[model samples]
Target chain A: MMTRRIIYLDNAATTFPKPEGVIRAVEECMRYRGGNPGRSSHSVSVAAAQTVYSARAAIASMCGAEPERVAFTLNATYALNLAIKGLVRPYSHVVISNIEHNSVLRPVSSLSSMKTDYSLFDVVGKAQGDTEGVLASLKSALRGNTGAVVVCHRSNTLPVEAPLEAIGELCRKKGLTFIVDASQSFGCVETDIEKCGISALCAPFHKGLYGPQGGGFAAFGKSVSDREIRTIMQGGSGSASSEVSMPGYLPERLEAGTVPTPAIAGALAGAEFVKRQGASRIDRYERELVEYMKKRLSRFDKVKVYFPERSCGGILLFNAEGFSGEELAAALDKRGICVRSGLHCSPLSHRVNNTLSCGAVRASVSAFNSYSDVDAFADSLSAVLSLR
Target chain B: MKKCYVSMSTMTLAQKARNILALNKIKANVVKLTVDQSYGGCSWGVETDCDDQEKIRRILDISDIPGYRFIRGKE
Candidate 1:
C-alpha cells in the first residue's frame, strides 16, 4: 500500500533530512579528502587534517571549549563509555540521574564489575525547577568515594531540561567530576562548558546536531587532565608510533584506532550549521514545536498527557487512554506519522514517571520540522486514538 | 608557487606546527617526509609557499618544537 505523506517526528533518535550543505561536505570528503587524518602527512592527509581541525574549531567555539579538548568517537554511547570508565575506578563511587540515557547508564553499570559503586536517583526536582531539591539529592548522594556525577542535560522522553549550571555548581562544591549526556539536547540547547562546569560532555552529532550517523564526541573541560582518567582502549593514534604506550594527549589520548574521516567531515558541517543558526534560534524553534504539539494533542478527550513543567527542546510525551503506546504508534505510522514508543531505553525514567508498564509516546521535533508538520501529527494522533 | 618544507622528528610536532600555521591564516600543507628521497625518517613536513618561509620559521621557533628543520625548494 502507498503511504500518505511522511512527517518525521523521531528526531530524538537521530535527525533525518540533514540541513543544507551537510551532505555535500560529506560527499566531498569521501571523494577528494579521503586521507586518514593525523595518520600520514601526505598532501591528501594534510587536507583531511584541515577538515578535522576546522570541525573541532566549530564545535569548540559553539561549546566555549578549547578545540584541542574535543575528541570524536563512533557515537554518544562510545563517548559516554570513555568518560565513565576513565573517571571511575575500582572502589570509587558515582552518582547518576534517573533521566540518563542507556548510553550513560550501561557504561556506569559496566563499572560495577570493576567494583565501582553508583547511586541512581531522579532528576524530577531539577525537572520541575526545584533548585533546592535538586541540590539536596546530589548532596545526599555524595560520599568520600563519590568521584563524579553523571546526568542527562535534557530528558529525551519528556523533552524536559534541568539547570546544568546549578548541577555543575553542586558537583563543583563537592569536588566531584560533572559529566553531561547531551545526546538528545546538545546543539539545540545551552551547554557552554564554563557555564555548565561540565568536566566531560558526551553528545551525538547525528542527533540534534543534524549530521550523518556515526559521528559523536566527548569534549572535556579546561581543568580536566588526561592524567586523572586512564585510557580504556588502545590502538594506533598515528602520533608517537615509536612508543608502545598510547599517546596521552587530549584528542589522541581518547581517540583510539583509525579516525572515520567521512563521518568527521559530515560532523564538521553539522557543527558549522548549528553555529550559524545559533543555539537560541534552534532552541526557540524546537520549543515552539513541542509546545504546539503538546497543546494540540491535549485537546483530545482520550489523550492522557505526561509532561514536565517546561521543556527546553522539541518533544511531547503522552498516550491515548484505550491504546497501548505501541498500538497508538503503529496506527500513527500507517497514517505517515513517525514517533517513538515504549520505555525509550530509560527504564529508570519510566519507573520514575510511574508509566513503566504502559510507556508513553515520544514525538520529538527538529529545525527541519514546521508547525504544519506538527498539525499533521496532531491530526494523525486524533484519528488513531480510537483505532486501538 | 615556490615552496618550502618544515620537517619535524615526529608526527605530533608536525601536526602542532601545521595547526599553528593554519590558525595564523597561512595556507600550510602537511606532507609525509618519508616520501622524500633525501628524507628517510618517518615524520611529517608542512609545505608552504616560499613567501611564508620567514613567517613559518618564526612561528616554528616560537612553538619550540624540538629538532624541527626546514627544507627549502630547489626552484
Candidate 2:
C-alpha cells in the first residue's frame, strides 16, 4: 500500500497548488498576450496593457479602492519599502505596532537614523484589550510630526486583529497618512479602504490572495496628496518616454520599469476566484476550523496553545511541554505534516512572547483545508507529544 | 433526555462556547446569554434537550470550569 502525502499547513509563508484559474490565466498571458504592457502602439501591447489594467481593477475592487490608485510591485516587501521610504521625511514622526512583519519593521527601523522619531506601540493590552486596544495605542502614539501611521492587519504569531476603521478615523482627523500592511490578512479578511480611511495599503499576492509569488500591489487612497507621498524608483513607466523623468501620475509614478504582467494576470485570476467564493464565507469557515483545532489541542495537558481573543485569520501558534518547538516540528515533518518553526521574521513578537529561543510551531490553515485534515493534524500532534 | 444548560462564567471565553456545542452534538444551539463584557466577551446559552443527559453531563464534567450554573430546560 502507498503512504499518504504530506499535509500542508504553512500557508502563512505562501499558498500552494495554485487554483486552476490562476494557472490558466498565467499560461494564457504567456502564450497570447506576451507584449510589454503600455509600451508599444501594437495590438498585442494594447491587449497586454488591458490585461494588467483588468488585474489592477480586480485588486482595487477587492480592497474597496479605485482602479487608477492601484499600482503593482514586485512583492509586499518592495511595496512597503516604497511606502515608508518615500513618504516619511527627515524629522518626521511615524507610528507602528510591535506585531509588524519584517517588511514593515525592518524598513521603519532602518529609517530610524534619519532623525525621524518612531513610536512602536504594543497592541496586546490598551483600553479595550482586544483588537480595539491596538487602535487606541496607535492613536495615543501620534505626535505633532506624525507623518504616517503604519499597521499590520494581522500578526504573524499572535494573529491579533487590528482595528483599522478606528485607526483610520483618527488618522483622518489628524490629517496623517494611514498605511496598512495586509500581507497575511488581505484575501481572508475584508478591507474597505473608504470606511477605514486608509491612505495606502500594501499586500502580497502569494499568501492569502493565493496568487503567484512575485507579484503584489498597493492601493493609494484619494485623500493622500501626490506631493505628500513620493516615488522611490524612477524609470520607464510605459509612457512619458520622451522625458527621462517618471510620470506625474498615480500608478505610473510609482510603478517604474517593466511590470510583471504574467504574475499580475495570475493574481487577477486568484482575486476573481476569491471574490466568487466570498471572503466572509471563507473567513467563517476558517474560524470554525481554527476553533475546532484549538478545542482538540486544549484537551492535552502537555500542549500549550497561543491564540488571541480576536483573530485576524487562521494561523495558530503553539508548543508542547517537555519538547522544543523545533523538535515537535521536525517530528511532525517526519510524520508527513508540514509546519513552520522559527522566529517567523517578527523578532520583537517572539522576544515579547518569550519564544525567541526555540520559537513556536505555526500551523496556518487555508481555504483548502478540510475537516479530515484537522483531525489528522490533531491525532499526529497527540502522538508526537506522547513520544516524550 | 433532559436539557443541560451551562453558565457563561464557568469557562474561558472560547472553552465555554465550544464545550456546550460538542456535548450536545446534534439538535443543539449555543446561545450567548450574559457575559463579562471585558474585551468584548459575553455569556452563552446552550440547548441540550435533544441528546442524552448522562452523556452530556460526562462531557461537561471533563471540560472543567469555575462559576457555572447548569439548568434543565422543560422537556
Candidate 3:
C-alpha cells in the first residue's frame, strides 16, 4: 500500500475500498468457513454450502430468477463466454451491439470460426433511455438463421445504457434468446430477468455491487431450459459423480469445479449491502457525480467529453487536447488520481464513438466516492492539462 | 420419529427441496447419500420425518424443486 492518498475513479474496472461488511465477510469465511461446499456432509462443509446458496439466492432475487438458475463464475467474462458459447447454436447467426465490450465482442468473434455468424447493430446516435433506434437496427440485422441476440446492458467506457426491456421484447417477439452482458449495470441498475424476458443475464459482483473481484454470475430466465445450453467446461459438480456427463441442472450443469468460497462470501455481503443501500439510490448518487464531473470538465478549453448530451450513468469519458489518453492518464496518476485510459478493453465502443485513434480517459464512480473526490479529480485533470 | 430420504440430483436441488419443505412448516436436513443409498455415484438427499413423507412428496412435486426418488424405511 502506498503512503500517499489516492483518489480512485476506476470503478468500472473494479471497485476500490470495498465495503466494511464485505471485507469482514471474506476474512470470516477464510478463517472459520474454509470447507469445500457441496462436497461433504460435515457441518463446516454444510455451512460453506449455505453461504454459496445465499450468494446465489441474493443474485437470483436481484435478477428475478430462481436461486438454482444462478451459476457463479470467476467474473463476467467467464459468464459471458459460457452464455454466448453455450446458447448460440452451431450454423446459426447472432446479433450484437456496436458498443459492446470485448467480453461480448470477442466471444461472438471467436464463434465465427465455429460457423456462427453475427451482425453488429448501431447503438450510437440514440438518446438516453431511447430504444427505438436500437430496436430498428437490431430488427434489420436479424437473419433467417439467427438463434440469439447478445448485447451489453451498459457500455463500460461510457454512460450509455442499452434499453434492455426493449431488446428483450424484440428477442421474445422473434423467439430468440436474449443474452445480456450486465457487467456494468448489475447491482447499480435494476435488472429483472423474468419481467424483461431475458434468456441469460451475466454480471460481475465487483463493479457496482461493491464486492471483491473474482466473483460473478449468470442468471438464466425461465424462458430458456438448462438443456438448451451445452456445457463448455465439465468436471465434478459434487452432485453426480457416477455419471461421466455433467449433472442435468441449472447451476451444477454450468458450475464445474470448486467455486471461490471467499469471493462468494464477500459478494454475498456486498449484495446485501447494495440491497440495504438501494440500487436506485446508489445509481442516482453516482449519476450526480458524473454530471458534476462533466460540468467541471467543461471549464477546460482543451477537454473533449463524448456524448455530452446523452444521459450517462456513473462513467464519463473525455480526452484533453495535445495529449494522448495514455499521456493524460499517466499525468493524473502522478498526482495520485486513478483513471483508466486507452480503449478500456472496448475497441468496439471506441470505434462507435470515433475515439479509437487515441482512445479516451474514463473516470467512473461508485457509492464509496464523494463529491470531494470529483473535485480533486477535476482539479488534478485541470492542473495536468495546463502543463501541456 | 424415523426419517425418510428424498434423493436429489445435486446439493443445490437438495437445498432447494429443504427450503420448500421449510416454507410448508416441515423441517428437513440435506444429507449426503452413500454409494449404497445413491443411484449412480455421489448424490444428496433431504432427510425429513417419515410421518410427513406424503406431504413432502406432494410439496416437492408441485414446487419446481425436482427430486430423483423418495427412499422410505431409512431411519
Scored by TM-score, the top model is: 3
lDDT of each: 0.80, 0.76, 0.89
Residue-wise lDDT of candidate 1 within A296-378, one digit each (tens)?
Answer: 97789898777645756787788788888999889989988999999999888888778899888888888999999999989
Candidate order, DockQ descending: 3, 1, 2
DockQ of each: 0.23, 0.01, 0.81
For residues A179-294, could you state the per-residue lDDT of candidate 2 as single tens digits? 89999888888898988999889999888788999989888887875556678888866443455656555676788888898999899999998998898887788878888888
- Model 3, which residues run further than 4 Å from truth? none
What are the clashing pairs of model 1? A41-B31, A41-B32
Choose 1 or 3, whichever is better by TM-score.
3
TM-score (chain A only) for the predictions, listed in order: 0.96, 0.95, 0.98
Better of 2 and 3 by lDDT: 3
TM-score of each: 0.89, 0.80, 0.98
- Estimate the TM-score for candidate 2: 0.80
Sort order, TM-score high to low: 3, 1, 2
Q: Distance from true position, residue A185, model 1, in Å?
A: 1.5
Steric clash pairs (candidate 2): B31-B45, B32-B44, B35-B43
**Deviation in angstroms for B30 in model 3?**
0.9
